[model samples]
Target: MKQEVNELIDPSKFRDRIDIKGIEKSLLVDMLRKMVLIRKAEEKLSEHVESGKIKCPCHLGIGQEAIGVAVSLVMRKSDRAFGAHRSHSHFLALNENTYSLFAEVLGKYDGCSHGMGGSMHIVDNDNGFKGSVPIVGATIPIATGAGLAAKMDKAGDISISYFGDGACEEGVLHESLNMASIMNLPVLYVCENNLFASHLHIDLRQPSNSTSRFAKAHHINYNTVDGNDVVGMYKLLKSEVESMRSSNTPYYLEAFTYRWKGHVGHRDDIDVGVKRGAQLDSWKKRDPIKRLADSLIYEGVLTESEYQYLNHEIQNKINSDWEKAELASFPENEFLITQVYS
Candidate 1:
């Protein structure tokens, strides 16, 4: 099973999968744009984290952008989404305002969470991004409850919870799955299986390489997907998300990916953990942005020069947003107390 998982994650297996047949150009371009923006925003966060500017720990999902893009594309504004520690991609995929994200990371007054919730805690209710927390499994049950609320409202809205492979070990996750399954709630549990829970590889933690087994145990419909394949993810999610929304049943998608950087910071953290240097390089080959862009170029949807120009434009936007956000004032000392709950 472990070997099968390895084969599934192998970059070589999906390298030639660049076809965009039958996919709308608008959706494909949007997916590529979001993926590129998320990667660049995370790179900005990484630089700040390494330079002592960002005090809070940042979990970069450099290689996990596709899951966020594909899942978010299928989501509606009425639906709610929650993300775990490594959720910059998820948040940005919904709300492209990187300025607010930068402010939140810097603890400024105009941040998404009013400056208190650093890189980990972010929120945008208008965009259906309910929140993201650093706590591993805290958002699982909350998302499930949101699903229940949506069901009661009869609005056909769904709840999405994005958690890592490590969160699978938490009891709350299983409980939430069981409850959602029995209640037939409209929830989609997205597990971003990045192959590592902190410094420990998943092989050392779980009997099976995939986390979808738990979904099967809970009798919830599930599928494990190639997280790097944005086109494939979009195709799969269109049906699954639509089915769950209409049927009011829970669904699970465990995205198999690899985080380009370490668990909590910018560095690769490859020194101690079994040599991931080669593996990391291979994963880069399957980079969502590159593959999608290459496919678009190959299919004549975009030229190489056009793709480069689009990247340049996004880079400039990110730089402008970050610069302005960093200059914003931090909140007053009493601000925290006022927002604090009893």
Candidate 2:
């Protein structure tokens, strides 16, 4: 299947640099760093999963890093962000603490979810990330409820729901969209449309590649974004996010991106059963981190050496964090009885 080729979802279609005109230097650098940190952390997870060090299944968003980073930067810390199964990026984008993630996956007591949730169930409420679950489309309605709560509180904070295109198949998503639209709730629905959801290419499941048609049905504003273009993504989502804050209405953003790693583990997922090898190589060309780094280097915002250094810096941090996470103690047998609530 020729996925995302020569289409609007294609990386060649979007040419704006992360260091584009009128953008702040610091913001660009920060976005780049966050994206790098997320990518490195996920890569480490992938390595461990392949080596059998991590027992928990991890979903790596290696190429789909831009959306989470851009959205995190655009949305305020007070805004509540909820994530779906593949939410390592969503969590790290806000907290940037891989130690918690590493610990959580390792089942250590100091994990973000106290080693109970593992990779799919991490939560960092202090950083505005409420939680992520393995259930598909579970948090859309929860985010909608948070949006309604935000409306009732009059606190000026919005709710963000991050899910993949596959979650669009769920009935609760439509209900959440309708409720948010009709009630004028301030919620931002983020769809990471990576063309393939869980080993099946989207063409087999979705009649039309775009999921924003549902937004039109609900009278909610919608936009399809180049999820790989971090700078462009920021400008587009930031405006919509700001507008949603004032209007108290819902906004839907569908980001077109691809995942370098397979659905579950570290491999391309072909030999394991998925027929994605044909298109996987091409999708790698549109890698989000590389695109942003190239643009930044081209625009002279940072040199190649600096970019390499940034990568090295993040990798070193990940290494240290992973070591610390490994040494952390696991919950004692009695701890389960104490922690489990009625």
Candidate 3:
């Protein structure tokens, strides 16, 4: 049965499924725009890194844009969201400020964290993205606390914690889940199970590939969905958010996704002793952005020309922003001492 389950959750076997009849045209277009924006922004960052312009470490989520967009669509600007290392998509999907993100990644003072935090330590409180910490499982408890604060206020606002399958191994995640379940806090755990924890595959790390089973252990309501399907993710998250809002209870969603790039660089890192190149190629065929555009075009909701136009516009914007970041000034030396304590 474990073998069967592993076979079923295989990333390469996932397919793109979008039902145009069940979605709105405008929302579909917006989702496509956001996904494309994220993909292009990451691609721009990849070029900067290859040219030695970006010194900071970057964990690009090249193929995992849909999950962030779906969840962001269900969240309000006041609701809090958090992310892990591979979280540029999470920040952009909610904030939609590529300039600030590019500045942040480039270590400029105008960055979201004012150049102190690089790609991993991103913060935009006004946008409700509390922040993203690089330390795995570090933000789980923080998000849980935010949910508790929301509960105390008796407000409908909730907190979303986005972590990878690797973070699931951390003891704090289980503790946070159990506490959230027992407290009935309005927290949502989005596990982007990309089947890889940095270099090792999920099969080598865990007994089972499914992370939602842990939710069962804590008796938390859970749902597993194909992370590549933006529409499906949006619908599922919408319903879950609604239930959490009404009942003020925690929910868990396990999104099966695959990162196109390697763990922490621009290259695919195929030579890193992992024979996942072919599998990565297979996952590209399940590209979420293209799938949505094709479905919309097939249903007369969007035109081929319009799709091309959107891509062109987004690419130009990302290029412009990258150039701006490239020319931006770094933080002043003395300012670094302000945020530190001895």
Candidate 4:
């Protein structure tokens, strides 16, 4: 069974899949647009980093955009979502404010965090993105707390906690799962299992590739899907989130995905003594953005020209936002004293 699961997650086997059925045309296009926006925006960040224009470290989720876009379909502004270091997709999918993200990473006052938090510390309370921290497994308990609050309020809102495979190793994650399960907290734990935690592969760290076993141990309702499949992810999350909202139950979704760039920069982490050139190439072939577009085209929901036009539009928007962020002023030195806490 483990061997079969491994085969199912193998990127090479799923590269040619462009299946879309019983899905709305508008949703397909919208998801495709968001995925493209995320990809192009992250690519631009790579360019800025390579040119030394940005000093802050950015963990780009270039290939994991589909997970955020899909999950955002079922989430409301009242529901809270938290993410980890590779969370650009998470914020954009919720707020659609690439300009603010750009400004924040550039340390401009026009940023989402008022130039205080960098890429890893994105917080948009109005958009229901409570926050994203860099520490592994840090947001698990925080999201559980949010779930508790939601339960207390008796509101049909849930909390989402996005983390990576590495976070599964943290003791807090397990504790958070057990607590949420026992309390029947309305929380959705989405683990983006990219098979690598920093430089090490999952084979070296965990006994099995899938992280759902932890969820099973906690007796939480869980489902594992291809993070690259936006439509599939949307279907699964939408159902589970709705169920959780009604029943105040916890849901665990383990998404199998891969990061295109390095663990922490524009370039592939190859220079840091990791050699995944072939694997990266294989994953690129399974590009989630391309897969969705192909599916839409194949299903007669979108034309090639329409898709190109959409890409052009999203790229232009990203360019304009990036330019604005570049021209934005840095926060004043005096403001730092006011923002500091004793």
Candidate 5:
């Protein structure tokens, strides 16, 4: 089984190289700016969580921002997306309001979930971010259902479910994949193989670290890539999504990346008892943002001064959004039972 999985991904056939020559300078700049904004916003969240200003448990996707940004660039407003606990990047990439995100984390009434859902249960139906939940594989089936609905409606929309590699352990994920494939549902299963479920590494949890094998079992078309390369993700997804749109078929993408922070919270600690050792440091060196920035510079598409200017602009925007969220009022006492169902 491991050999079959290993055969599925050939390193020689997969290239880290990306062509940015035809990509517009302005678009590239915008992508870089969005990435910086995500980074800074998470940084602020970290500060708040650590200072005890934000009481809710937060999952920061500091190192995995590129995956969401790259995927969103090609997605339509009508398409649906679902994410797991570490999902700030996913929401932000879909052009969801950062202020609402901040407010939701602060449990303010102006939040995306109207201050009720806290960090985990964020939703923006207008933005096509159906929702994000804390449960590992819960959203997989939900996304599959969305895809089936899209197919029934004859809509060109696709459903995307983003989850960590750990979510593969859940039996429902495989069942969802099988059903989606059998029905020809228009869903994209994106497994961000960050190699850890909380503190346990992929090697410790499964026989083979690659999650694409499961996709193969379902007879779904799939691809694996270096998750840190935003441009690479864009290139691969552009083709795969186009194919899915035409055929109304399901596909899978296993993105190999790492998270800078631990499983939960802004802290580097995985938990009170677990040790991460030097893995975090090694992952930092493979930072997606830095690598993409370097590639942009190397390709002569972005200069150092231009990059700095973009970073400054993003920081200012993030600070403004944070301030607005901080001042937003909490939900009124009477409103608590208003949105609830009997």
Candidate 6:
């Protein structure tokens, strides 16, 4: 009959404002393009969902694109990565096909899951993306298995699992962390702590706001960084991933961020209820995309005109991909029973 209380961890204490020096201009531009592409793609998906074009439920990662893109930059094709419901950015960051994503969302035959799995169940093996699912902490063990396989095969590949802060509440995540740490599995647990699991904030649910305490419980080496700052995350992940690859050790990264949209759809304020109005507005001021672009322009790495042009190019690409997917065919009735048992 004993109840346990969870303490909230202050993420701002670990915030590191990393200098964006030593990064090439070309790479910076590419990062910007990736973020813009993700934003535009999600925007289009929102429109489609509103129009009844996409039947599947999507957990859009509108404000959390930079974390995936930065990590993807450091990951190799041999490494495996997995995501949860809010994972479009995870798939796209690894350079997954946009048309296939569109097709999948549309339930077309050309979807990444062949029209079988919708938004939450995307897979891209060619790009080292194992898969994404809706179940919280479901992929944690899978990622650990992958890391074990990579170790057994001596493939020099690590497994990365991206999950929400809510997922840390699951018992499986704790077990997976313990196993990875004890066995020295080459897995990186990237927790995208957007501060909410559906409508409830972390303070209301967890005792500690910092999820890294769980990592410490398992003796895992962990780093907490600003999820909005792509440059900082990229640098930190580069080092952490390198260590995992070299020592076959497990690493944990907690990214503090906020989602611009509602939990499952396009509406930003509808499902969020009354308490979120002011909090949401304040978070918007800490916008990742705008901050990064502003920093790049101020640092002379990118011009305002160039930034505008890049946005135009990314928007065009998203529009074109959506159009192509819209015209794509759905899976034939006869093919329904296929790919199930195999």
For model 2, residues 233-281, the per-residue Cα lDDT tens digits are 8988878888788879899998988888888888877654344776667
lDDT of 5 by residue, 1-342 (tens): 472234222223323334565578777766776777788889989988888888998998998888899888889888999998999999988873789899999989999998998889898888789999999999999999999988888878899999988999999999999999999999999999877788887777888879899999999999887787787788889889998988999999998877788778877874532335655666676667777687788888889888888788778887898889989999999888777875
Error of 4 at 155 (Å): 1.4
Q: Look at candidate 1 and give me any clashing residue pairs.
A: none
* Native RMSD of candidate 6 (Å): 3.3
lDDT by residue for model 6 (23-62), tens:
9888887888888888889999999888988889988889
Q: Candidate 5 at residue 314, lDDT?
A: 76
TM-score of 1: 0.97
Model 4: ten consecutive residues of lowest lDDT: 1-10
C-alpha RMSD of each candidate structure in angstroms: 1.6, 2.6, 1.7, 1.6, 3.0, 3.3
Give the per-residue lDDT digits (tens) of candidate 4, residues 203-231.
88888889999999899989888889998
Clashing pairs in 2: none
Q: Please state the error at residue 213 of candidate 5 in Å.
A: 0.6
Cα error, candidate 5, residue 191 (Å): 0.4
- Score each candidate by Cα lDDT: 0.89, 0.86, 0.88, 0.88, 0.84, 0.85
Clash pairs, candidate 6, are 6-207, 6-208, 7-207, 7-208, 8-207, 8-208, 8-209, 9-208, 9-209, 9-210
Which residue pairs clash within candidate 5?
none
Q: Per-residue lDDT tens digits of candidate 3, residues 129-163?
A: 99999999999999999999888888799999999
Runs of candidate 4 exceeding 4 Å displacement? 1-4, 271-275
| Selected candidate, larger lDDT, 2 vs 4 | 4
Q: Which portions of model 1 show Cα errors greater than 4 Å?
A: 1-6
- Per-residue error at 182 for model 5, in Å? 0.7
